[model samples]
Target: MTAPGTDAPSTSAQDDVLFTGVVVYSTQDPEASAVLVSGGMVAWIGPTETAEGLHPGARRIDATGCLLTPGFVDCLPTADGAAVDDAWRASAASRGITGAVPGSAGIREGMRVLSPVAEPLPLKDLSAQGVPLAFGSLGAEDALDPWSWVRAAAHGGDPAQRISDRAAFLASTRAGLRLLDVPHPGALNLGVEATLVVWEPWDFTVHSSDIRTNAWSVDPRSRTPMLPDLTEGAPRALRTLVRGEIVHDVPGALG
Candidate 1:
């Protein structure tokens, strides 16, 4: 797809693009540090050491000190009556949002999108009951940052009812994709569309709901991929790619 706000030609799907030195957040391979996108699909994911050798002539993007994850899907409406045009899509892509189900579309599809308003819903309880919960901005006029919704869901409401950071992140990403029946449902596995975001480096930790547990859940034994520490504030998106094509890129982010 053509990048928003740019008349420049789009990247050809036949071209190979390799991103190295990134912390890839993939459930299928949590330790992956590099990714190869070929023909608009995820061709490979593994350690950085093997990337260059496997794809010798691929265009390389040095993503050192960055975290790469599936692009977020917005489950809320944009500014009231805002046209879903290139400008709007460009703004959302800058914030790592790749897709959306705005306004009545979400409700019509039976997707539960909770607004970040006073008197929060019982997120943890609803999540425990297999109720798929997705959090969004307070209103149409609110900023279109998915991280804010994640933070609200993870830390708002009754202390006992707050969801874990990981859960909230998934709700903002994979859950929305699944609800919309998007192919592969937000995963970065081989052959899947390479729609993702590269984020500025940030501290990360595994979150736990248990009060007795240590504040930082860094045990490798858990085998859980680490997520950005919301306590330290949200990380900025350096680049956003849709189907292996650059949609938004911050200057000097690839260096």
Candidate 2:
């Protein structure tokens, strides 16, 4: 993978890559620790030991102390009339955003709201009512950092109206993709396009709107995927991959 802010070296579709010793966040296999990408798609995902037996010649990426998850998708409008370009894409990739749908029109079946909402609308209630709510950035530049919207929605507004951090995260990722009617909205799974982001390790906690349910939610049996502890601030992206191709990487991140 190339370093951040530089164009990624061209890679063949047949190239194979094995990422080991990383925490993989996937709905299909929450406990997975390794992923093998082949032909620009997810070939296999499971325990690191199992991955060792597959794709013997695949390039290896020792991603210990990292969290691998689906990249964020941004639904944003132009920034001060500036169109989305390579620089903007690089900036977004650096922040763990892999795909974007420019402009705010034609987004039905789900609600897309700007963050730091000036008016507190019963967001949690709307979600509970099956509104399929999602968040967008106020400006194109701010859109790059998906956590900004997550933080604003999860922690802002009246306590009763605030959504849980997990809910906010879903709105920023899968929910946005669902709004666009993309097949298999979220990117993590076997045989899906390997659009992913590896983030610096950070603390995580299971958050819920109800204090009574918080304890049970953290139980291992729940198989819940913990998200970054927003109170400690958002984790930085160490690398970003689009369809298994390295689009951005922080220098020495894997070393």
Candidate 3:
């Protein structure tokens, strides 16, 4: 994130000429322009500005600039269990936002700590260092897996294989949250790993590639693949995918 601009603080954008320049703003529609922002919030909008008595303090900024709308501020959790905060709160705040929320399994207080950090980490040090954590069911090491694997371990457990998926963890977490569940997501320390992969391991061997690839699974912010509209009818991908028939056969169809 670009550091917040350093300049004179403004009580308001109008009346004082802090900076003045052509600015463009947009809406959900790609071809739509809604309101124009001045200092940080939306200022004058619609039909393009031709206002009188422009503020001298206003710095001239180009309106030809493409609008970079902020991401959707998720006010709720994706799953039924806890409240989830965005994964990039720190970076977002560096850009200006003050409020943040996160929700994920085992992100609650007093969970176990496990990780591949070279530095030895105990429970106390992990929490202090803002380490990624999981529920009591999983140690820090288990949380670091493919998204499906993490969710499976976090939500469920498999004693036969000694493997627990995120779904199992999620169930445990929900049960843990019988009272006031402080919903928050865990940390994702991947940016540095990406750097290492780029600069250090250009010639990664098959074994090394396997190790790096096993570093972590794709961390999709969303928990599940959004199915298409049910109203849009069934998808064609389920060829020979027997969905048990309710009636023996449709009125006009052959079995």
lDDT of 3 by residue, 1-255 (tens): 111231222223222111112221122222222233343333343332433233334443332222212211111122442322344333322221222223433344554322212112243344346543432212234322212222333222332222222222222222233213433221101111000000000111111112343234222232221111122221111000001101011121111
Q: Deviation in angstroms for 37 in model 1?
A: 1.2
Q: How do the predictions measure up, each by TM-score?
A: 0.87, 0.87, 0.24
Using TM-score, give the best candidate's number: 2
Listed per model in order, the count of residue pairs whose N, CA or C atoms clash below 3 Å is 0, 0, 48
Which candidate would rank higher by TM-score, 2 or 3? Answer: 2
Off by over 4 Å in 2: 1-13, 78-82, 105-107, 116-119, 140-144, 185-187
Give the residue spans of candidate 1 off by over 4 A: 1-10, 78-82, 105-110, 117-119, 138-140, 211-217
**Native RMSD of candidate 1 (Å):** 3.1
Model 1 lDDT, residue 197, Cα = 89
Candidate 3: segments with Cα more than 4 A from true spot: 1-25, 28-35, 38-41, 47-59, 71-90, 94-98, 105-255
Q: Scored by Cα lDDT, where does model 2 land?
A: 0.74
